[model samples]
Target: MFGAHLDGVSAGPGINDNGSGSATLLENALVLAQRNPTMTKRVRFAWWTDEEQGLNGSDFYVRSLSATQKSYIKGYYNFDMVASTNGGYFINRITSTTAAPLKAYWDSLNLQPEENVEGQGRSDDYSFQQAGIPTSGYAMGAGARKTTAQATKWGGTANSSYDPCYHRACDTTSNINATGLNRSADGVAYAIWNLAVAATPVPDDFSMAVSPASGSVQQGQSTTTTVSTAITNGSAQSVALSATGAPSGVTVTFTPASVQSGQSSTATLSVGSTATPGTYQITIVGTGVVTRTTTYTLTVTGTGGCNGGQLIVNGGFENGTSPWTGTTGAIGSPAGQTPHSGTRFAWLSGNGSSSTETLNQTVTIPAGCTSVTLRYWLHIDTAETTQVTQYDKFTVKVNNTVLTTLSNLNAAAGYVERSLNLGSYAGQQITLTFTGTEDYSLQTSFVLDDVTIQAG
Candidate 1:
């Protein structure tokens, strides 16, 4: 605020001069009071009516407060001659004042909010600072000497301040600096946020985090990291773990990948020996107020040799068909019996009889295979004109775990193959079974063959 002015202040009623700041102070006070409990900090706003005629309103306020009441105040800010500025504004901590902290804060942001040219013109900050209180705030200024130093550093005319409507009837509502008002509003917002958090009323959850969290790391090394989020009132609703801000050649993999609610998750960060050594920052983005950042320290000092083995499984399929007699019959072979062209085919003669039972082969996973993929194939064709029943749906199982619970081999050229994730059952004996029985017309026949599993 620059200063408070009076309407026809010099000639008559002193309402317009100080009325604006008073109205503002009253509105601000009422709003703050209403939201006081919800506010993270306490806010104080006051109105000094009739600041004109000689700063009488302000003087009276000072004289009216008790010593103890005044002592509770952190600082006091004044708004005298605010609406009266034609020259740029200036603030005096006191005529010969020094408010370095407040000035420095303004200087850091490169704003020409106020000048100390006269050092002591007028305002509330003056009385407060004189009482050993630190004061700071922004004001709409009048046309003042915008120093080459302030201008070069802050940018504008090194010779002109902000406003040019100081103390004149030309100082209508239209003469006010909207830019100054907007900027002051923004400053107020920042002050409110900072104060609300600093008041110890409510914690600033913006800085919330995930702890025992991941650290930085270099490329090519495998490291485990734990993440825990400390929340106030609202624990992180859900934290998603991801790799980022790390050096090249570094890669990370997670166990659960994401944690929901207060749940915890561990991730495995791997950097290849080829990885570049450097610090890596891991970020967890979520509904949390703050974007929590944790790092996985990576020293890519060594090459990487750690990784999972290839998943492979060598297993046969079980169909009631004749045992895979390396003895080739006129019909086809067994199911799951082939590799990387990765297909399996089975053919059956049907013996011209309506075989009501499934023709199958027993798939025995040997200890030699790391993992296994089982495929079942069969072709059913009836030569007789009489209607026949097609047993097209079948079940595929890995040992007792049902990999393919049910599959409908509904094609005229009946064929179905399912890929199963069997990495967990490496080197373990497993079995694949396809169970389904079909009724065929007299002379109807089918073929089953090609059950295969590739090993690591």
Candidate 2:
């Protein structure tokens, strides 16, 4: 803005010459200050003290600022001689990205704004622009004549100075064009609001998730699952995929292993038949500008009673109790009075008073087995007068659950064949145990020959 004084001229009120620009700028500042608006950048308004003496006021202002202070100014916009009697809209010819908003504002109103071809470096904005700050402004014509084209567009008199009052005393209240001043004020507000405000930056980030996060697979087989990634904010970047905590014999791979942000990728998990049978937790990770993790659960089945034929390791005592564990009195396959399927049989004879003997074996029931049967030939001879009460006994168990108990008092004929239904324990791993006990009275004996478990 310029409030210059002409020492030699008598009618140098200078209202139209600079007062219009000064008033509009002050009004814009007042409205914004009253609202106490928050903006990313600071805005300051200035009114130059002299212009007729060669831009002295603006020159002195620029020279007073420090180099760091000057650099802080991003842009400068001058409003001088904006409202003229024959006013025509004009925008400063600023050749930079900052010029976009002003140009766009005019375009939005369907107004054809011209460049300041007449008064390029004749304003206060020139001072800041010279110090490397981006500068732009709007001006109604001064002493320059408006062309026929300008008259047609702005509805003004052609071939006449835009402001006839120029720097004369007549450049007072009567010299102002209300419509032109209002429109120019609006243009100033538009540029200030858009250019002075700072924009917030969005963070570059993404999220990850997996479908069917947990699953189960049978031994000797492989299973597959997927992992996906999605962008949350900012520009696209490559994201790499990986997996951890896979058990032995298991392999995990990602397809198109890396994907651009805002996009997704896939991962597959495979387990070999020889993979260990147990539960596992697998971690799937996505890494790039950002990182994320997810977990998956997988269970592998163990070998059991799936294959046909006898399931026990050594069904008959003819193998000398190779697969069975014995814990107590007189447990061995000694030459017996009778043999069930071989020349030798298992015998559990009382070792002393109040003593017990236990023999057990663990077996796996394979997959697809519906029913199981355990059959054996046994003999018991005890001196006890009563069954469990006198304490000379024999007992059988499956997986820690007692199945039967007997004593010689109720013993069967010399040698008896017994069978047990193991249908409920199908398709599982189980332990089978046999126990024999004797009281202080006398010794007792429990014998077994062929012991077989069959599954279908």
Candidate 3:
């Protein structure tokens, strides 16, 4: 490809025309050979001795190959005139799909390149493409004037030949641009790495686990829980999640409805106050290439109607003081006041003096009862308007030991209902007491209504 002294012409150096391609190709082959690369496909390099004389060596080599031997080639790429002086980046406008990697290298540099105008069918790759093999190549321009558009895209003097001494005697070491040679060498190396490497596809698969999978909810409250997802036997993927078979008035929501593989997310299950009382089984499913399901149990309690259903005697006080014993203060059923439920409710009043009033009830614990629940609606109003400390107070007790305290300072807005788990005293007879005490100056009233006790 260099100085072979062609017929009827003086012997001269051809370093800028085909010499740059031959040298770059040889360097690439030598580097790969030095590394002893373990490649998926075999890479073969050819140096055509007479490309200057109309591609005689490459044409003879292709004609000698059998059809089976030719079919082994997936693609053919040529590099010619790659380091011309004042080189303008150029890529072959290939008619086949093998041009993607060649185009990608220029695109990654954000460089706008022109097509291979000077070295189209005039190189050794033309023989491969004529045999229906996919072809792609790279070339720095040769003997062509750089237009104004090329100057704007590649930043060079316009209307001047890319290589002023192409195919001349002086096209020697001085004819090469060091920066262009380095960039063109890097591009050729990238093409070899992109095309000769084997790729393995990843399979999509995952699993899910909901921690504390079983839980309880009050008839009208919400709960938040966590679920974790893990990718199994695959690369990262997005998994869509959903819930099925939830009870009435119970809504389930996932914070991130979709999650990346091998990562965990949270799902909040909100049970409305009017939700039906029962045990519900909900299945949470995550869908991707494969579907996975996890089951969660939700138990709802305290739907009222406990007198004939085996627990409370007068929960709503509709029977009017039949089962409760009042002691030590003015405590009675008040009429025409706001009640949480039913017409009458019990009220304990401390009219402007420090006094304590209490209501007691003795309930026999049913045998084999593993858990007990106490729920009631409460209201407190007081004239004690102080921030640092509380004066008028109300409390609940079991056997005269304080269980929980309530006051005007901490009471819910407008008689909200609350629940208590008395599972520790499941098999013992217990005295449940509701007490209210007022300080010396301000009068505060404590009201209780719509109470229920259940054993399960």
Candidate 4:
């Protein structure tokens, strides 16, 4: 879904404020209709109204979606004020998957775009984001002043507002930046075509494949493998290499930590005399604009002995929330909420009003642990009457990356066992977090208990 606000402030023509975005969308739509290309995914364009009045149109549209309808929407992209006279190119959530194509399009033109911090939570995209839909967007600028560095890169006077005529009577068609408009329009088309209308298979920006996928070494020995990358699509980009899951007394290094696409690097794994003896799965991660990972199995034989065990401390919440950190009163035994086991559990966000609560703990997984798994039991109860709308949400994240999300739509009567593989982070310290959010009207409780991170 692509969206832009059509309404403007009543103070002036508001040409540059939104006319630029509206024009860009209109032109793109016309071109798409003319071509009538085969589409891999459906494309929907929306011109919102009453946006200047606190994004009411977009918010209402998102709130009206049923759980099934929301699931069908892959992402949302917003374009607003893209042709400010002195505008600096900005892409919202530039590192997100939904924004990759937008950033790539700008990169292809040798233009470095910055994140659109000036417009955060001020546009229609924020409405979608609050509803758990992935969102990204493009913006030139608004009333914010451009810095000297921005002027040097984007060619405009320093200390000047991106649009001098912003919200004024002078903000007529003359306020538009021709060059910015042309460039931005092309980018919008590029993104729409690549995301929805492309008929050919979309190649990954790059690939990461290790030569020796598995190896065996004794304590005090070493092994080597080659990490190779190729530019499957677009121009070459720099990829940084790192390895994880090495046990204690083991060191993993790359000859050159970073490599350009279509290049290769050597990874060395050295084991010390005190290294633990076990079978380990080492994950090699290549990070660029996007991240790619591959696994290498290593078997270590040594005289030292150790047995796998649970890595998390006080996971069951019976000892209180010592190692865990979160909102006050979030971890405790509560009436009407049964714990999966023990006398306590984490109960987050049962308030029938707007509220947010979180619980997180950091733990290190020792080396030499073979099969690592995180397990928990979850129970959800909601006071929401609707069966289709997801009025409340629960999320689980590892190292700040989302692993799973649940909502009022997933409410059930009893506890359900959940398990996730943690082999990739076997020898790493990671933070696990559970966050719950409730809307203004409904109360939903996300209950968790019997949490454990076990390694064998």
Candidate 5:
């Protein structure tokens, strides 16, 4: 799906804020209709209204979808302010599969696009994201000032707001950057063509292969390869893609997750810092009417030494609670409490009533390590006035064995570092857990962040 807001603010003409995006979408739709190419997947174009009123239009559309209906949508692409006089090329959710085609289109033009941090959670795409649908888009930038690096790359004045007339009366057709608009429009078409239409007509059957079938990566690094498909015998059909046989400390993800036969997708292999160094075969399976398989050889080179081996995955809670499981709202970046380091942390037992919240992840301590240590930063805050009462309690445990315990009595103003020597548990798989238990009166919050299990 491709979408843009049709409504604008009450300020000026609001041409540059969204006129550029809407015009681009219309032009692409016209061209696509004229060409009338054979499409493997359905393409949707949405021009939403009331976007200025807190994304009400897009939010309502998403809220109206059933689970099965939502699942049918492969991805969503949004275009908001794609043409600013001093704007720089930016891609929303740049790391996602939905952004792959847009990024590739920009990269082909040597545009050196950046992630659109300034517009995140401030646009219509946020609506689709909340519905768990993959979304990505383009932007020329908005109220943010262009930095010197951006100016040098995209050729604009440094420290100037990308859109000086944003949401203002002066925003009109004259404010649109023709060059930026042209590039953004072309990128939108490029993504749509790559995602929906096939390059060449073929039969119903499809053939699959991976480009650069073998690659090498170092620990703590990542690499990507393209998975291509071509129609062989039958008509185009959806091919669901998945990867398996990855070793521990390694993760495999596909951008589109699934694609119509004859469309290609990007497969990314991320190697954790502590991944065992070796060669491995990763199988990419595409299941459509029939299952087709391809293999990619991955060689993992070690970074060397124990200091480079951190066993914990997403210990800092930066990756949104993957590999760790517990309560629904246990891990997040809530407004009241700040994390020890990153924007997210494990927050437990702030409910103020009788409650228990637990967060845990399982990892193996490598056999040959001479020393192993666990470290985390903790911040405790409480509404309890009494200093001596241990009303709310927090505990750290390894393999269900208590390592240490603290209470509201230990509450302090800021974060404190806690460390434990785990040499005794070396060469064993263990579950590290943090549990918070609150009593019936005052609320005590136990926040943990920047966790790591290092072995030497």
Candidate 6:
């Protein structure tokens, strides 16, 4: 494959064989200029000649260069017989330190691992490598037209060789084939750039944590919550965090003055002196799609020096509230038209016309009680053809503050079983004020059963 002879019997100009690589390099360089390649480290590209002449051209090029010029290069890549009908790349790392960046780059991309074989650096890289520089290169398969498999896969002749009329008397322009050229070009380009950018392709790893996975306390007594996260390789990253849905009288703030990526920092969540006690869902969202949430229980002790267990209005009375407000619409009960039992309570809304009536009642916890719970039934009651003017909703207030307002008297059914933090009302009387949203528009009375008072 030396200098090509037009009619053979002499050296032939192997333009297509290696000229392709040289031409490609020049074109690619121009393209790089257009691309505005930015590099904080360094950038280098080279074209080698006399590769068929025992790499003499590359050797002279390396020998003539100054030590500084040679030292500037960390690795070398030789392109020899890059377009041969059948030829393979080889590496030489004895004198030259191998360029490990390329291998690391390939590994990070999750690409297939390279198979180890001998015969490397049998090209221009040998000259630079002899002076101590890492090297790598590529090669083509033995002389043959496009492969049958290659043709099918890449739309090229399968049984034919890429360089059909390889280094022979017939090795003319006709021998050169463009089959799979685009694919080959693309593959090389992708690999080079992929390696080039692998330096900073991936961001650092991060982690977060919330202490006291779950906690419970009587309202009024402050509880300290801790926030923390781990930074594995976040050497230079910013981590910001914020929270919502926390109970009143509670203050949450991140420390180290700022929330950023790095080390375990301390952040304190302070439940204030006047916090309403209840099981609240607090969400803490981190930067860049990281999220975590915690459920905290703030139990408020009620008057009467008693704390009742959890309850559900229509959940079959696990914890009974007899005589307090039994939901049984039995004898003498003149509320909702629907048949009522202990397990089924009347949902109070204003939907009661003259025929339909809602059950309404109020309870007060003595000054000794810290909190109270009134569990009932609720649902979205959509007006049917019979009742057109939908009117039913209720507001609940503890002393003065409206804890929860219910418009849940709709067509769909929903269970109501919730707790309020009552630490603030300890020794202070609390009255649950239930006011009808509308005056008998639906039901004149709001019937809520299973009223339990947890008095301290």
Identify the leading candidate in terms of lDDT: 5
lDDT of each: 0.44, 0.69, 0.69, 0.80, 0.82, 0.44
For candidate 1, write residues 222-333 as lDDT tens digits: 7776655454433345556666665566666766776664566666667676654333455544344445655544434322211222222222323322553321343224
- How do these models rank on lDDT, best leading? 5, 4, 3, 2, 6, 1
Ranking by TM-score: 5, 4, 2, 3, 6, 1
> Model 4 Cα displacement at 303 (Å)?
92
Q: lDDT winner between 3 and 5, please give it.
A: 5
lDDT of 4: 0.80
Model 3 misplaced stretches (Cα beyond 4 Å): 1-37, 199-456
lDDT-superior candidate, 3 or 4: 4
Candidate 2 per-residue C-alpha lDDT over 1-456 given as tens digits, one digit per residue, 9 for 90 to 100: 212221212222222223223344334444554453446567887667676677788788888889988888777776677668787877777445655566665555556788877768887767777777777776787889999988898787999998888877788777876666665656566667666643443457778888888776665666666677676655567888888898898888888788886666666667677766556788988888878788987765544424434677666666656778887223344554456666776677544477777888899865665547888888876655564464677888998788987776655547788889886886688999988877776767787767877664
lDDT tens digits, residue span 1-456, model 5: 556442222112222233223344334444654553567888887877787789998999999999998999889888888878889999998988889989987887778899999999988999999999999998888889999999999888899999888888888777877777777767776678778876564445688999989877778999999999988765788999999899899998999999999999999999998877656789999999878889998867666423225689998888877989877477888889998887898888988999999988899876655557789999999999996878899998999999999999889999999999887876788999899999998899998999988775
Per-residue C-alpha lDDT of model 4 across residues 1-456, encoded as one tens digit per residue: 566452232112222233223344334444654553556788887877777889999999999999888888898988888778889999999999999988877776666999999989998998999989898887889899999999999789899998888888988877887666666666776777778875543444788899898777777889999989988765678899998898898888998999998899999999888776666888999998778888887766553322345667778889978888887387888897988888898898889899999888898866655667889889999999888988999988899898888999999999998988887876688998889999998799999888888764
Model 6, 1-456: lDDT tens per residue? 001111111222222333223344324433553443533334455566666577777788779978887777755654333343332221223222342433332233322223223335445666776876556543343354444544554344566654455555776544433322222333344335434533332345466666764455444444555566565442435666666766677665666534565444444556655655445566655563343333434343322333333322333332333332422342133343332345444444434553332222344333444444454443344343234443555565666578775542334443345455655654444555444454433343344444444333
Superposition TM-score, candidate 6 onto the true structure: 0.33
Against the true structure, what is each candidate's TM-score?
Answer: 0.31, 0.37, 0.37, 0.39, 0.40, 0.33
